[model samples]
Target: MMWREKEQVLMFTFTFVIYAVCTIILFNIMYRTQPTPYMDEIFHIPQTQSYCKGNFTKWDPKITTPPGLYLSTVGVLVPLAQWLGWEVCEVYFLRLTNVFFVFGNFYLLYCLLLNLHPQISESKLLLSCLNLSIFPLTYFFVFLYYTDVGNLFFFLLMYTFHLQGQDLVAALFGVMAVFFRQTSIIWVFFVSMAAESSVYITMKRTKLEKKSSSLQFLKKFISTTAALPVHHKKQFVNVLIDILDTCGGYLLTAVGFIVFLYRNKGFALGDKDAHVLCFNVSQVCYFLGFVLVFCSPFLLSPGKVKKFISFCIKEWVLTAAVTAVMILVLEYLVQIHPYLLADNRHLTFYVWQRFLGRNSLLSCAFIPVYIFSGWTVLQTLQHKDSVWQLLYILCLVLSVVPQKLLEFRYFIIPYVLFRLNIQVNSYIQLFLEFSIYVFVNAFTLVLFLNKPFYWEGQSEIQRIMW
Candidate 1:
C-alpha cells in the first residue's frame, strides 16, 4: 500500500510535468496569434495596466466586476515578475498571471478532493483535479487577463478551508472571493449552512429519521441540539465554536457587501443597466443541460438511462406534471435578452437561433431534456448530507435563475462545485471523461486560433468562445 501511494505520487509528477509544458506551449501560441488583448481584455488589460502604473484612481465604467483582479496583479504578480525578470505589466506577462493561478488552483483542488474524500482513491482525485483545471470555461481564461481563473481559485480555496475545519481562514478567503465576484457572498452563506447543519445532523444522527413529519422533524432537530450531551458534548461545543467563528467573520464581510450594494445602488459595479435580474426560467434549464453534457462521464450510462426510463414509466404522472410546468414557463416567461439576439459573435446566438429558438415547438421540445438533467444533478448529490443538498439546490437556483444573460461562463463555479462532489470509482469512466474533455479543448482552442473572422463593422478580429 505504501509503495502504491508512492507510485501514485510519481505518476502525478509525470502527468503534471507534461500537462504544464503543453499548457505553456498552447498559451505561447495563443499569445503569438493575438498579441493584442481581445474581447473583454480590451477593458480588463488597460484597467489593470493603470493599476500597475500606480494609478489606483483609474476606473473602467464599462467593467462590472470589482478591483480584486487588478489589486492582486499589483500586489502579488508584479513582484514575482521582477524576481523572474519578466516585463512588469506587459500584456503577455500580465495575462500569464492566470497561468500561475491555474497551477495554484490545480493544487488547491487536489487538496480539496483529498479532504472531501479521504477514503477515495488517490488516482481518481488527481485525475479530477487535472481535468477540472482544464475545464474549458475556466481553461479559456487561463491564457487571458480575466477574473474567472482567480475567482475560481479563491472559491475552491475558500471551500477547501471550510471543509478542512479552518473556518476563520475559510471566511478570509471567502471575503477575497467576494472581492473577485459579489455573487460569491452567496457561497459564503452556503458553506456556513453546510458547516452548522453538518454538526447538528452529526449530533442527531440516528434519532432524526426521514419518516417524521415536518413538525416532528423540527421538534427532533431542536431537541437533538438541546440534548447534545447524548453524544460527545465537547465535540458538539467545538463544532459550535467553528460555526460561530465562520458566521462572525462572514457577517463582517456581509455587512461590507451590503454597504457596497447600497452605495453602488445595485450588484453590478459599473454596468447596472445590462445586469438586471429577470425571470429567466429557461436559464436554469440551460445550465442543467450544460451539466448533463459536460458531466456526461459521470451521468451518462446505459444503466442509468434504463433505470430512468423504468422510473419514468412508474412516475409518468409526476414526469408529465413537471414537463407541463416547464413547458408553460418556457412559453410565457423566457425572456430573450437583446444582447443574445444582437451579438452574432457569441455561440449563444447560433444556439438560440438554430436550436432552442428555431420555433415555438422546438423550444418546448427541450423541456424533457431539462427534466432529465435536473434529475441527474440531484442524483449526483443524493449521497451528500441532506441539509447540504438542500443548501446546494437553493444556492444554485439563486446563482443562475435570475441571470438575464445566457453566457455559460456564469455557470462555471456551480459546475465545478457539482463536479467535485460526484464520486467516480471507475477508471474507464474517468479516462473517457478526460478524453472527451481533451477533444473539446483541442477543438475549441483550434477553432478560436484558426477561425478568426471580421465582425460586421468592428475592426478587431473576432473569435468565438464560451
Candidate 2:
C-alpha cells in the first residue's frame, strides 16, 4: 500500500508539472504574438493600471464590470510591480496574474476530483487534469487580463470546499466568485441546491434502508407518504430539518450576493445595452451548437443517448409543456427589457447577417435546433438525478437563454462542470477530446493573432487590436 501511494504521488506530480510547462509555453506564445491589449483588455488594462497607482475611485467610464479584478491586482500584484520597478511591464505583470490563478484552478480541480471520487485511479485523475488544461478558454484567457479565470478559480474553490463539507468556507468563496463576475451567482445557487439535495437524498436513502421490506421501499418511492409507516414519517420530518441546516451556508451566501448587488447599484455595471434579456431563437441554437462542439466527445455514444431519451419519453408531454412555457416566458421577458436589437459589431450578429442575409424567414430554420438543444439538456438531467447534475444543467441552460449577446467565453464554467460529470473510460477517448481541444484552441488563437479579412469592420478589431 505504501509503495502504491508513493507511485500515485509521483504520477500526479509528473502530470501537474507537464501541465504547468505546457501552459507556460502557450502563455508565452500568446503573449509574444500579441503583447498588446486585446478586446476587453483595452478597458481592463487601463482600469487595472489605475488601481496599481492607488486610484481606486477613478474607474474607466466605458468599462462596465466590477472592480474585483483590479482590486485583486492592487492587493497582491501592485506591490510586486513596484518592487520590480518595471513601468511598461506592469501591464504584462497584471496579465500574468491570471497565469498563477490558472495553476491554482488546476490544483483545486485535482483536489476536487480526489474528494468527489476517492475510488478514481491516479492515472485517471491525471488524465482528467490534462482534459481541464486543454479547455480552450483555460489557456486562451490566461493571455488576457480578464475576470473569467479569476472567477473560475473562486468557483472551483467553492466546489472544492463544498465537497469537503465546509459549508461556510464554500459560501465565502461563492461570494468572492460573484464579486469577480456578477453571473457567478449561478454558481452560488448551484452550490446551495447541491448541498440541500445531497442531504435530502442521503437522508431519504437511509430512511428507505430502515424499512422492513422491498415492497415498502417501492411504495415509498412511488408515493412520498403512501404506505410509509408512522416511524418513517418522523424520519422524514427530521430529514427536512437536516436539509434546512445544510442549506444555511448557501442561504447566507445568497443574502451576501443580494447585499453586494444592492450596494453596487445593480447586478452588473457595464454597458447594459451590450447584453439584454431578449428571446433570440438563433442565439439559443448557437449556444446549443457551442455545447455540442465543446462536449462532443462525451456525447459520442448514441446508444446511451437513446436510452436517456427512451426513459424521458414517458414524461414527453410534461417535458414539452415545460419547454414551451419556458421559451414563451423568455421571449416575453426579452421585449420587456431595453436591449439593442441589432449590433453588427458582435461576432454573433455578424455571422447571422452573413449567413442568413438579414432575412427574418431564415431565422425559422433554427427552431429544430432549439428543440434538439432543449432535449439534449433534458436527457442529461434524466441521465443523472443528483443535485449537482440538475443544477449544472439548469445553470448551463439559464446562462445562455436570456442573453442577447453570445460569446464562447460564457460557457467556460458550464464546460468545466459538464466535463467533471462525465467519466472518461479510456485513453482513446481522452486523447480524442484533447486533440479536438487543441485544434480548436489553435484555430481560434490564429484568428485572434492574425486578424483575417472576415474580422474587418468588427468592433473588436477597432477597439482591442494593437
Q: Whose TM-score is greatest here?
A: 1
Tens digits of lDDT, candidate 1, 218-308: 5776676777666758857765665455466766777888999999999998877998878787888898888888899888888877878
Best by lDDT: 1
Residues 1-466 of candidate 2: C-alpha lDDT, one tens digit per residue = 9999899888888888988888788778777876778667889988888777777788676776678788877788756656876563355778888988888988888887777557777877878777786687767787788898899999999888887788778888887887787788887788776653443454465554423343454455546544334547776666556666676677777787788768866555766555545555444555666666676666546775676467558778865675565455444432311212344333444554554334444544544445555566545544444444545656766776666555656777877876676665677777777888888778767766675343546543431121
| Residue range with the least summed lDDT across 10 consecutive positions in model 1 | 197-206
Residue 416 of candidate 1: its Cα lDDT?
92
| Alpha-carbon deviation at 25 in model 1, angstroms | 0.5
Residue pairs in clash, model 1: none
What global local distance difference test value does model 1 have? 0.82
